[model samples]
Target: MAKLKDKRREKISVATEIDRLEERRSRCQDNLERAEFRSRKEKLTEKERQELEDEMAIMNERVQKLNKELDTLRGENRKNMLLSIALLAISAFFYYIFFYNEEDP
Candidate 1:
């Protein structure tokens, strides 16, 4: 119930975060490519090159963190699914014991 809703919300949040990180990474790569193109055409100042490298590093780190978070969410979902199946099986066993016995000789 409440736990299920919480898991769903967390899954959505993780997915959103992954999407955002991916978008940021794409933008950063595009900027890096533009800087490289400019450098080839003329020359990039040391500061500009350093800034581009720094931006790329930061974006890469963020994307890696987001990927890890997505993996964790997937693991949690798998665990929850397994737990639910076990609980359902246990409940059914108890139900059979309580009801099926009554119908037997």
Candidate 2:
């Protein structure tokens, strides 16, 4: 029973983590787009341009990292789902075998 609660908690935590990471990734993408538009639409000093470029690079790296993390989390979630399904199937099978005697009409 304790293990079941722990597993449920872990699953919820992973889902929450995935949601948080997705939000971060969305924000990063939005910032990156704005940066790109600013670079293309405005005239700026060399220093300003260099700074923007650096910022964009950092944002790009962050977005990549977030994407990788999200992928890993999603994969883990899939594995957990499969495991749960298998466990349920096994439990049902055992229950049927041991507790589900059929009555003849």
Candidate 3:
């Protein structure tokens, strides 16, 4: 009976140690994430400051890839807008010169 009690106490001790380690790990993770967020926040430029709302969206989670995707989307949108405007202007000029000649020869 004494041996069984000792074994049970050993098991309880091990369980408590595991719980303590888990708590420490959770605290460490929280601190690390907070520090990372602080560091990233402190390094923004004025342009980036305007887009900090976007950074907050990704936060510390999946941020690198999300930021890359956001940048890519913004680039693509800008390129597409310039392409669209160029096409519109070229078409307007072509239409005017080909169909609306004011000189009668």
Candidate 4:
């Protein structure tokens, strides 16, 4: 039960992190789109263009990092699930050995 709670907490935190990263990425994309539209009408100054590029790079890096973290969390969850299954199986085996019996005539 404690492990279950821990897993739930971890999942919640990961979900929250994913939501935050996605929100940030969307905001960055919106800014880039606006900048592109503006540039099409006129032209971006060199510094403005550089800043946009930097923001894009930073957003990409953050997305990649978030993806990696999510993968790691998935792996950990898989491992824990397997461990739990093994533990349950062992307990069941012990239960059968101790409690199961055949009738003797």
Q: Each model's TM-score, in the order given?
A: 0.55, 0.83, 0.40, 0.58
Error of 4 at 70 (Å): 1.4
Tens digits of per-residue lDDT for model 1, 1-97: 9999778766675446556656765775676576566656866689987886677677567656756765776677678779989999999999999
Query: Candidate 1: lDDT of 62?
Result: 67
Candidate number achieving the greatest lDDT relative to the actual structure: 2
- Estimate the overall C-alpha local distance difference test score of candidate 4: 0.71
Query: Which pairs clash inside model 3?
Result: none
Which ranges of candidate 4 are over 4 A from the true structure? 1-43, 102-105
Decoy 4 TM-score against native: 0.58
lDDT of 4 by residue, 28-51 (tens): 667667656665676779998788
Better of 1 and 3 by TM-score: 1
Report the lDDT of model 2 for residue 66: 100
Q: Which is the leading candidate under TM-score?
A: 2
Output the worst ten-in-a-row residue range by lDDT, candidate 3: 13-22
Q: On a 0 to 100 scale, what is the lDDT of residue 14 in model 4?
A: 44
> Residue 94 deviation, candidate 2, in Å?
1.0
Order the candidate numbers by TM-score, best to worst.
2, 4, 1, 3
